[model samples]
Target: MISQFFVLSQRGDNIVFRDYRSEVAKKKDGQEEAPPVFNVDGVNYFHVKVVGLLFVATTRVNVSPSLVLELLQRIARVIKDYLGVLSEDSLRKNFVLVYELLDEVIDFGYVQTTSTEVLKSYVLNEPIVVDAARLQPLGPAAIFMQGTKRMPETAVTKSVVANEPGGRKREEIFVDIIEKISVTFSSSGYILTSEIDGTIQMKSYLSRNPEIRLALNEDLSIGRGGGSIYDYRSLSGSGVVILDDCNFHESVRLDSFDMDRALSLVPPDDEFPKRDNLKLK
Candidate 1:
């Protein structure tokens, strides 16, 4: 069971702390209780560090030591996605997001969703960036609906050359299809085996819970091309892409994928990566 969670700076100052139990936060007379010493006689403390901040989870019960450690790493990733950077000042400035994420990840010291991709589905807000010309940083709640912080004027012009003057380019997410082709050949050059391993990597900045449909030319049949609905005639007629041994993020509903023949997703917000893998013959 988890007793407390803390985000400590490199110097060990508490950037943010939360007590999961009510008694830990209050005294017998109901006055506020002081912070617990990180090292207690019987408790075990697990720590994970990322980008100069330490994430600590303390517990008194018997639990998988590795599990608590993994939780800290996942928590840090989700926070990094939200804040774009992790540091003493960044966590301090974005304390609310940290608290909100910690609550969503662990319920009363039990591990909940450790998938940062899934966690991003619940955590909506992102850190604020401001006008670059003035080089002034805005307050944390300031929303930026336009493109990312200023690119070089030349780079910006190059990106939107097709747009009419003064038309800003839409900030669309980028999806990367990475494939590693595996092939074998005898010294005589006769092919023995071949397969394709691939993954779809997405860097998203869409609106809250944006639904996406990814259409590919892959010939998809519940069974095989022998199915009357997708017979050899049709398979040979249209250019068909073939996929084998595919996998998807847990958020992807199998029923929808089967019905639509499209990869469906509610994409995560800015800079979060969603990866799905597949093998093709």
Candidate 2:
């Protein structure tokens, strides 16, 4: 069976996460200014959490839809292979959850692309295996399965030449894998705060319960090979903040932004007051 895949890009303003309930007032000139946000230098730091995945399936075959199922199965196999560390039963359950979640995302206006040539089909594979007793009988179980037939080969046209010789662009395999299990994944994120700034913020997949926290006060310095503070002066005010919790239990991997690599973000004078400047203005 032939499978057509497309990659998802983190592009456009259409896919935005705005949780505000109340609308901000617009200026009389009709220009709405962006709301207050922290500036990391010149750019705003936006935290990203995986809401869900979206699958846009377009049937290119003129007569058969067998490949769509094959494509979905391939996606499921990849996810199960790479991310299946749980028990057999739990793995299966989460695989199904991914299917259901992607379905829900597609239904909730996630796929806003306008491609009339291809018909859109939403498959929510969220099976109610858990709490099965809570499910009410909508009708006869066999009757509900009536419409899910494999598309016949007669319905599709056979091997028509593409108008463009290059054909369509190929999608990234990871994106489809993400979309395939989008419904089932729950993100485990953490709140990161700086002691010097008293700032609190959250980030997905960063670990709420870290395995370690290294407090780097003024004059205190650390690095992999005992690098000196003068060697790190090029880093500016950025410093590392470490937390020791089970979540981030991995060995120290420091860079320009992390704790082991540089000095604390506090200004040097503020931390160690100069003797000449000790005289109050």
The digit string of per-residue lDDT tens for model 2 on 1-281 reads: 11122212233122212212212221122133323222222322212112122222332223233434344334433332222221233334555544433333233323322221121133323222221122244477658658775333211211111112364422211100010111222355432321111222111111122332333343333322443333344544666322211121123223432443232221110001111100000
lDDT of each: 0.59, 0.26
Reference-based TM-score of each model: 0.49, 0.17
RMSD (Å) per prediction: 12.5, 26.6
Which stretches of candidate 2 lie above 4 Å from their native place? 1-56, 59-95, 108-208, 211-259, 262-281
Residue pairs in collision within model 1 = none
Q: Pick the candidate with the highest lDDT.
A: 1
**Root mean square deviation (Cα) for candidate 1:** 12.5
lDDT of 1 by residue, 1-281 (tens): 78888887766677888888643332222233323223445666678777667787777776777877777777776666556555676677767777888888888876688655677567665554211223345566347524555533222111111222464444556666677778888999976766567777665544446677777555664324334323434666566644545666655555556565777777654333344433322
lDDT of 1: 0.59
Which runs in model 1 stand beyond 4 Å of their true positions?
A: 10-13, 21-41, 100-171, 176-199, 208-210, 216-246, 253-262, 268-281
lDDT of 2 at 152: 35
Cα lDDT over the full model 2: 0.26
